[model samples]
Target: MLLNNRIKAFVELGKFLKQFKSTGYEKVNTVLYNDDFFDEMILKINTAEHHNGWFTKENVVFAIEQWADALSEKNLKEWLSSYQLDTIPCKTIGIVMAGNIPLVGFHDFLCVLISGCKVLVKQSSNDDQLLPFLTSYLVSIAPELNESITFTKENFKDFDAIIATGSNNTARYFEYYFGNVPNIIRKNRNSVAILTGTETREELEALGEDIFRYYGLGCRNVSKLMVPQQYNFDSFFEAIYPFNIIINGNKYANNYDYNKAVYLMSNYKLLENGFLMLKEDKSYSSPIATLFYETYTSKETLLTTLEKDEEKIQCIVGNNITPTNIDFGTTQKPKLTDYADGIDIIQFLSKIK
Candidate 1:
């Protein structure tokens, strides 16, 4: 039971996007630059600095496809059929975007859209193009939704609810502004890997993609590595040696050169890499240009510790021993079906009723 016009509108958006293939680096910035009036200072960031900042043609097209796939009538019906979203009094929902990674703000948009509410999105300064371009196309495809969407940087007010994603520091600010309001506050987090078994060369190479994609600036990227105490670094290095080309690339190579010199000069305990940082520590997240990895003698103890700290862990990216749906390496892109922090957002909203 859906309106024919709405369905056609969504499908047409998909049709428009299917024609695009994500471009590399500067081309992506050019397209995004053309999309909106972001402040020039933010737009002029070094390419090596904001690796995933560029949303190439393929990325944009995939984003549209992802939106279409998420919004299809059949999928909505199936999702709704699983639970009673009707119990909640849904209305306008505001979302504050996170620009640290590509489309990190999209899940909140999906939440508002799926819950049958008008969406008011405030684009992050670091990300001004994607949403505006996207919504514009959607409006063209289906004029009916023109009323359902709004984008702005206005001081947010007059919203029934909101979702905000920011760094651990900014989350306090978000809480001050929107804490009383019903919302999902997403703070910065990074995924981890639990190594229980040995990995093949193919698997290690795949791990390289997980580490380097978006230049390791994403929450989904494996920012930390866990290996057994006896697991020597030889086989691992051999597997990733082929990716020397990737490590030696412009941005990555610079990160390597800088970090390597800093570690040696400061006498910090860390391994050398032209790109990746192999530090021995028990943490999940890393700085934009850093990696934190540690080894453990006891697998069982590590799993228990991880379970105890599940709040800090977002997703696991690895081979063999990861939990179901945690993701293998090759599928770097997440489908719209994937929920953030594994929370059932619809249920989260309904609980307040």
Candidate 2:
């Protein structure tokens, strides 16, 4: 299929997704294949939590809304404008997807197909349902794309390159197995926020979205905070209070209770506001319902530390804190060009031999 054809199909998929959003689902009569897909998609979104407890209906809807906004013709063209998609030689690309959040691995799947390569996907069983259904919708829109997408339960074979996302442990195995091929193997990386004690309450509340979205499971979630020395937590707690309803969910409440109990039993000093816990730590990865924070004496020293540990960080959220800093509340709403771990998948695929 031509690149334009693929873009048109994805735009249709986006339109189909636009019907289902956080506000509500509204069926558009003009959307292609809705008679076959529209109602089933709603069922999947509503019952996603049955497969994975973290896949709440609200979060799943939020994810769909984000993708609906992202796959616009304008956005797709802008993201692909710099790439020579037609010139890239066709090869079968293997994708090992992580199921940390709903549709977390869809970007890699989109890139492989858009670059004119066949994709062999091994989806994490935790998130296996939604993507296949969406891919089916895409295929229904563009029958030619049916040949380009494959989902597998067994080992991948007959692939020229690989893209794998997992923890640090699985990364070692990915490097061992796919080491000879052109591959992008991503490991554990966390996002952090830098506070200068000048952020408005709105910005701080927005930061709560970054922290609490996906229940803090995504690599882009701000799991840690870097605040100025003696920076007070009063404002931060007050701004994030609106999100306290997150604790009402049984799974989240269980995690919060368990973590809090463990901390108290261990005699750890904590700053908590009923639902969320704030701890003083240096680690980038924090547990559920907890946000780790560290105080920095100087901006220069903090930048130096972040630079030194760049590979361990996925995003740095703040206002002009760094050249690449993402604004607050937008970490989960990544653009297509915002490639994970700062590695461009298009450039990598274009050069694959």
Candidate 3:
């Protein structure tokens, strides 16, 4: 009953927030540009988060509620019932955030919040400001959250359990050091796309949003492309080239220059656009200026390979219509309820709570 009530409340909140399209978005984006948020971000991005550009505040709200709705009836019930109900209490959940993508750690934040756990977020110093400001905004909506959620600068030590994300190297340490407790220690990963048949120009236009959103600095970004061998590259390039904005300015240019030198020196075939580069690498997630490639024979073979490598892939951002799991599988924008690690998040939080 309580869970149902909370869902209804969230829906109501969504309804109320829907009207905040223009002004609310403006405020959030404006605040992100302000130095206040960057104080936390500086630990990671130096001065770059501000320099790179902030996603419209509207993206944050849109993604969040998109997630809330994504975690809708059927999915929510599947996961929620996976564990027994009855408010589990006496919890303080700590989250080690990720900076690979904008507000990537928000899922863990939402999980802990929903599970009634005291959230002690050890934010990725890279994205310090976003989670803090986001938390503050949530508190504004649900004032009771002010008491529950506390964004901290203090290093978390004596927590019951933790949910952390880091590079494979850091994940090793987190798993060992945090081994004394139950936690979700995430290693590095990213999403990809499989362009089999036809993709429209508008779809490609929209697809560019996924590629350049954070200048390809996100885990959800399509760093790998799996196209059928017969598919000509020209159409794909044409569909995506208009949003060639990824190659401009400073930060992105640095990435282009650096990777271009390495490729030029090593004699690798690099398709360049000043900002984005396509190189032949097995790396699922490429550096800012580069992308990985593997030609596929058939969709069946591609599915088989992907299924085998499911553990490595994080999300799939393509133009496919069908819903997929073990895949962030969506051609359209990803709804919020979609999660990373494909783990039972609420259940994970519940145990700690």
TM-score of every candidate: 0.81, 0.99, 0.77
Note each model's CA RMSD in angstroms: 5.6, 0.8, 5.8
Model 2 ranges with Cα > 4 A deviation: none
Which candidate model has the greater lDDT, 1 or 3?
Answer: 1
**Where in model 1 is the C-alpha error above 4 Å?**
1-8, 22-81, 85-88, 247-250, 319-325, 351-353
**lDDT tens string, model 1, 1-353?**
13445445554544443333333222233322223422221332223134443443333444444554555556655556765655666577888888865556876775666555678999887666566656676565556677878888897878887778778898899999898888888887777765555667777777776776666767777888778776677776677666566554565567677877777798878764555668776767775456787777785776777787677777776554536425457335665456677767777666654
At residue 216, give the lDDT of candidate 1.
Answer: 71
* Root-mean-square deviation of Cα positions for candidate 2 versus the true structure, in angstroms: 0.8
Backbone clashes per model, in order? 5, 0, 7
TM-score of 3: 0.77
What would the C-alpha RMSD of candidate 3 be, to one decimal place?
5.8
Model 1's alpha-carbon lDDT is: 0.64
What does the lDDT come to for candidate 3? Answer: 0.63
lDDT of 2 by residue, 1-353 (tens): 89999999999999999999888889999999899999999999989999999999999999999999999999999999998888899999999999999999999999999888999999998999899999999999999999889899999899999999999999999999999999999999999999999999999999999999999999999999999999999999999999999999888899999999999999999999988999999989999999999999898999998999899999999999899998999999999999999999999998887
Candidate numbers, best TM-score first, in rank order: 2, 1, 3
Question: Model 3 off-target regions past 4 Å?
Answer: 1-85, 140-143, 318-332
